[model samples]
Target: MGEDDDGGREVYGKMRAAAALRQIPRPPPTTFQEDLMEHLPAAIYTLLSCWTRFYQIGKNNHVVWDEAHFGKFGSYYLRREFYFDVHPPLGKMLVGLVGLLSGYNGHFEFKSGDEYKEDVPYVAMRVMLATFGVLMVPLAWYTAKELGFSNRAAHLTTIMVLCDVAWLCISRFILLDSMLLFFTVLTVFCLTRFHTERHDPFSPDWWVWLTFTGISIGCVASVKWVGLFVTALVGVYTLEDLWEKFGDLRMRKRDYINHWLARGLMLIGMPLFIYMMSFKLHFIILNHSGPGDAQMSSLFQANLEGNDFSKNPLEVAYGSKITLKNMGFGGGLLHSHVQTYPVGSQQQQVTCYHYKDDNNNWRVEKPWTLPKVDDAGEIEFLKHGDIVRLQHTPTNRNLHSHNVVAPVSKLNNEVSCYGNATAGDAGDHWQVEIVDDLVFGKREKVPRVRSLTTKLRFRHVLSSCYLVAPNSVLPPWGFKQIEVSCDKQNNPSDPHSHWNVESHWNGRLPVGETKFYKSPFLRDFWHLNVAMMTSNNALVPDADKEDILASSPTDWPWMHLGLRMCGWGDNQTKYYLIGNPAVWWSSTLSLGICVIVIAVYLARMQRGYRDWGVGEWDHFLYVCKIAGLGWFFQYVPFLIMGRVTYIHHYLPTLYFAVLMVGHLFDHFVFKSRRLKDTTKWVIFGIATGIVIGVFWWFRGVAFGIDGPIKEHWGLLWRKSWNIYESH
Candidate 1:
């Protein structure tokens, strides 16, 4: 009887195993055609079709010099811009696809020398952006489905996101903002699905959730480190998801906690890892260098290795080039060039480097600097005003009077220091040495730090020099900003250092609890720990320098209206500036409007949050805190920027303002607590009004102002593109 019973049980177990195996067999693979099943994909394709055509619009125009990304596509197969410029490559990748489909005629491959054709590239890019913009509708629909939202509401959210001008403008640009949005949306969708499937521990749902998270974050990080901000924002949502599961569930506390821990590991942690991994791999796939200086790669590697990088996270992980640890001593390579501007000088006198072999020994040769020697005739400590003359450079004698900022080399182009075999021009040769620079401090009782400048310059145009400061002031510099200038031309010895004719001016801007200085959301926000104002580093081209400088007074031609231009399409160069006044006004308005709207939202929610579950408090806190964080990361940066001259390295800060404002708009307009109709209209009016009003301020009103504005509206357009003179 026992043997018979054992046989029966074994047979039953086999039958169960077979049934489970049958149920979980591998599914069939999805075909490429399967992805384009219906109206949704078709709409996406149509939208994309327009931008692919428009991005290369100026291919045949021959009007402008064609400095855009699409115009340079044909220069290389992958068609990326210059090596060191930091721009996300996803948009360019799409442009490449368009170029391929268009028989190398779209934005990526369109261009004839320095000019472009008609509306082709622009139109193409716009359509592509529109498609991506519209596609958000369906993706949001999917998110709603996963989040248990009704089809109707999901569809509504899609429509709202699509119609937003913020979305529209971002999509239209050859930038990564839209792509970042796309990734963000994808992450939400995946996370929603994961939330629904958490109960099934042994199911394939976890893997599905993991894969989506990885893809979404990889795309997000590829576009910008700003994606990290999104990651942090979503963390609140994750905690909420975990908290909800922990309460009123069948599982014990430990089991529930484990579920959340697993989810965090799979979703957030894995996503971050995959996001960083793509930075290393994507460039190889696209055949382009990854985002500027292989930063994304090194940052992740350093974190994992935990090898000395964390000691100064500021240097290793700043968005721009900070000295990399792996880059090695004095940030590696060295003794490149020397460019110094005695406190009173903007244009510099350079002293370059050379190498000589005496008999069998080699020595690094500098310009034989004549520092202030002691009475014993030995070179000693520097003080007061002392000049070091150059041994090789001619005194820029033949420079034309009309040439306001001509290159010194142009005055002696006849000299063949370049392209000749004698000066090591045919190989990777460099001048090697180091120089120390002294800087003023701003922090209380903070002593000045030594700045070691060592680098390798192009074709061996190396130089060497030292600097001395009164050593007064505090927090001397960001250490990186220790150079003499932020402007490129003023940097006679090295191109990397920045210069600002005005940043070093004595005294600080007045600071207090003004609207601009106050934190929009949070109280007790950190004061400016350090500040470094910079000038645009873009060089004055040989052909345009004279024309640019001629627009303003000789004293500060850099402020000339003629050079203050940045526009595209219909606006062109009317009164252009890289920074649109309309945009700034809109951004500022967006902040004020956002606060007003969110405040009204929370006030209404407080009236009835008690009726809902604890989840309401979590959501409320997120909204409240982020509103403050938005100001910290965005509004505050801009307000601080306004206190000083605008600089180039601060360009990324504008993006922060734009994105935060967009989020603030999105939160109140689309996702605010289900509120009254009167509240919705009120919020909409304020936010929309502010944006429009600000836009108008930049476009129509800035040039009309008199006083300093009237004297040189032409010179200040780097702040806006279209000023009156070159006024």
Candidate 2:
């Protein structure tokens, strides 16, 4: 009886222990382990990057290809000169800040192909970029771990990134791409963390991850518009997360509303605020006028101290010396000189030039006589329907247009300056018609000509055509400025035909609102975004120009092309941007493997053959789906973009591909039930060996080791693998 009681009690105790284990939640890692994992990858990445990125970063001692463009922008920022770029301002601002902190004097011109002076301190800037690049590897690794990959898998992904030649090249230079990549990976990592904490909805940890994800979204997007893809990814993920919460039977109605409110504020509101803040800082810092002033409105330019528009507003009169500006997008000041278009008609070429030269100035005179001051002591303003002659100030020739076809537009009447005996003839006379509403109080019959506010159209009296600035470039004879012609059909609403007086020399009218004009941040933000979009759209390659290193998106997946970042001579120091062939091929093949595995898994499910529990497989699929979406979003969009793209553009996509490969290897090979341990080890070993060996072979290219082009060609006999042949 005593033995039976003892056995029964032992069995009861075992059952109770099992029940307790099922009830308790799986706890997170200890703080010490988390710290070790985070710092270990970071330390390794930093050490590797420092050696590869800084060893001979300044060997060439001259400006690399794109450094000229971005370096000048940094100088402009230090000098407080406003400029425009197709990308957002944060990356350039950061570069400029680093240059400033490093004691760079902002005096270098940084012109294309110009050798940097020995004292330029370009290495400091290169190191700053390298730091950002170094962070990308660890960020990718951390992101993989957050998305459920094991430490080995995460470290493998980091190794793939560190070995990529393209990533190395971009990181070792002074470019915005490295910073962009860093922010993109950081954003993904934050969003992944937020996704992982969804079980504890509305908790402080949940809000922290969500908030940081929003901040990362803003940061990434501020680097380049391409970051919008990551933003879209976050947005979609957020929606899905909230939908999942709504469907949960345990979630109360109030909890659902709270979830929506919290996410809306953090994800949408925070990023928008941060994005606008970047632009606000940009406008505040760049106070003086610079090369990009011509692209802005006259009012905005007037706010700058040194711009020509900052002068006192001039009175409008018949004989006023004025510069007429085409209101069309990217139009310039109406200009003409003694030079004629060499091709068609051969008349003196009339074009719109952006610069402030004497050739761009003209005298507005009445066809009959110069006007006098009115009884109110105000100069007689040029009114609508008044016939006038625009005399070139430097050449003393009248603006003339006839039925002759323009050099750019064969159907339009060519505009030119006539200096012969008929300089003041009726053919030179044009009717000035005001197109804007007169808004400077009532009784402004002759609309008070405000510099940017007033718009006018000049109709040729003889040719019955309206003077217009088409978006065509004139020939070399015309200094390659925008073509000015007269179209037969006049559209009052056409911006190309509208003219604004950019600079006037009347000494009577007082300048208004020069210092008091404070444009709202929202308005400026909108204008800047529009300008960036327009500039990006205009980046198509010219068919007449030959770019030997230009590549197509098709060449990116196969790693078939390379870009020459810089070179001193054929046999001297050179940097060619390309990736390790073995890694690229293997990662691409892994993508194919992912497709096959997903297909097989689905087929097995259809056949009612379950390999894992429903919950576990669902979680695994979620991770893979997010990573696959990231890869697709980063790459497939480039295929449709019409602008000029290069192999460097594929680096972001390559990052996700590496992660995808790591995930597949961990889940399919290491965790597989069917595959033997020996088979898995063999496959892993072969891939690792190829990657490391190929990277070693190409280390010379990334490290800037000087070698002859012929020798490199011999080393890489395959045409597609030869980096020198790409250029």
Candidate 3:
């Protein structure tokens, strides 16, 4: 009886093992037709993408919205003229390359709403940038597949990306948005591919994908600062992966360390190297001095071709005409304009300007001297602790500060060009206190002031305050320049209070040699990055000013606003930047649905209910985490940012939400065992049909609306949209 029972139990165990093996999924036998069918979806998406992106891309022959700014930057690149902007150089460099390839001469000034000249290759440039937008569709399809979605879900992802009117419209212009979106999608694609190769760690394919992911990250970040949001997503995924590897008991300690090292090298080190390389190329190409020369260091500007700083005298003497540059990062030249502050002091505005002009030049004179007085006395070289009056060369007004509060920095005294050179009082007298030089340390005795080398501070004689120029910007009354104030706190370490003679002119002193003004690459790199960040931060929306094109972050997911890309004249071609309603609304709805489903699954698991097998559960969690977390990481930062945002800013974030829609549909409808295959195909057909229909209806907004926008009714799905002239 015992032997018979054992035989039965053994047979039952064998039956259970066979059932488990059957549960594991397997791919069908491959054939030429099957292989072709597998790639046909992405290929079809790519062809469709080309038509949509390139169709009528050149229909508008005028500069549209931001095309004015970005296209001008491209011209600056082609002319090899140095210019400064809030973004990194990679995207603009590509723009210049496209212009070069199109035989553009970089001669046309891309002013806003200006018509393109016959010789200008604006069409070719637009088509080249639109290529980035076109590639996004196929990349999305493959990204969905790498994330372990079904073919139906991959098709859905491609359709949503391809049909988005906002992405299509922005790509049709010569702007950085297309490049930013392309690299953003490419980063995610490479990340998913790397995640799939995790089962075989340290394999060639794994390293290749990881390297590509890092390269993509660098490219994305080099396009815009917002790319850091996607990079943060990669960081979170890596941390989770490393933590899982650490928990594996079967893994050797050496192997785990190797994993960390590989990730560190590929993700951190490689991206940094690539980012720095872009800046290096930027510096190499933009070697000539241009409008932005004053934004850089005195030593840096001396190297530029058009700048005459190298011809300036090395030493500063009494009556020397000089431009005082604030030594702080992102600081500007000491400038005084004809306009006066409305509230504070009501004197001529003493501010910091980023452009070189005669207004920025000041003459260093003895406090006791009268205006235009030729002193027959000995030529004395200016030294530390010299009491001098900085007379504005153009206006002849002395640099003056008083007890009145500054307009911007209330705690500091207001600085202004108060009285004429001969009529200034004790307030105009500033004690020249020498700070340590960049090349030379503090001397034991009084050190003679040297151009582009000595750092000095101008202390108010009456108020005992230090002259300062922080990153604070003045209002329009001050010509939107940086605010200059007198700080009450005499902090010696404060860089804002440090100033150096940028351009010195004295007949007595010798010219500065080129070697004396050489600056290091790393220093210049750090300086430019800080400057970019400073200018970008200053772009906060003003309460007193109304920007019609700006939109709140809350308006993004729902498509509550649409931007007019050009004038609404009946004869002019108009483009409205808005997303496809069907795609946007459905994708946004999926984001909320995803959170609820994940919460329910977690609660069920806590109660010991099994809705999915172990393998199936892992796959579900992986897909959801990628889609859900990617959307969260990209979207949340915009909510807290104070900078002015637009509808186009959300394009990168939209890609992830679209992925969530695809994944949720695949999980519940397309790949569900409870649903018949026919039902899944029908659902897919409805979804595809709705997206296409909506895209077709709104296609005029992207392809360029010809007639009066008021005639194009029903396009304003959202009440807040300014697409129509009445609105």
- What does candidate 1's lDDT look like per residue over 1-727, in tens digits? 7655775656766764553343322325557676445346336533543343233332223322223543343233344321222333444455555445444443334332333444345445434544554455456556544543333334333433433333434444333445566666666566556555554653787668756765676566555544545455456556765665554334478877776676667656776565444433333433343222222222222222212323321211001112211111111111112233232222332211111111111111122232221334422221112121111222211100111221332221111111111122211122222222212332222222111111212212222221111111111111111121112232334423211110010011121111111111111000000110111111212342244422222112122232232322332322223334433444446556656866776787778643334344343344334434523442233333322222222222333334334455444455556776577667666654554544444432212122334443333436533444333
Candidate 2 differs from the real structure by a C-alpha RMSD in angstroms, to one decimal, of: 8.0
lDDT of 2: 0.77
TM-score-wise, the better of 1 and 2 is 2
Positional deviation of residue 50's Cα in model 1 after best superposition, in angstroms: 7.8
Give Cα distance to truth, residue 461, candidate 2, Å.
6.2
Q: How many Å off is the CA of 543 in candidate 1? A: 25
- Residue 331, model 1: lDDT of 17
- The sequence of per-residue lDDT tens digits that candidate 3 reaches over residues 1-727 is 7655775656766765554353324334689998788789889988999999999889999999998999999999999999999999999999999999999999899999999999999999999999999999999988988787898888988898999899888888899999999999999999989887776789998999999999999999999989989999999999998996666555699999999999899999888998999999998999998888888888888888887787888778887899999888898999998988899679999999888899999998888644443556667888888899899989999999999999999999999997886687888999999987766677434369888888899999999999999978776667667899999998999989999999888776688775455878898888888788878877888877898899998999999988988888999998889999998999899999988998999999999998986468767877888888888998999999878999999999999999999999999998899999999999999999999999999999999999777788888777788777553
What's the ranking of the predictions by lDDT, best on top? 3, 2, 1
Clashing pairs in 2: none
Q: Candidate 2: where are CA atoms >4 Å away?
A: 1-38, 246-254, 326-360, 367-380, 391-421, 424-447, 453-499, 506-520, 568-571, 675-682, 712-718, 725-727
Could you give me the TM-score of model 2 versus the true structure? Answer: 0.84
Q: Which candidate has the top score in lDDT?
A: 3
Residue pairs that clash (backbone atoms under 3 angstroms), model 3: none
Deviation of model 1 at 544, angstroms: 19
Question: Could you arrange the candidates by TM-score from highest to lowest?
Answer: 3, 2, 1
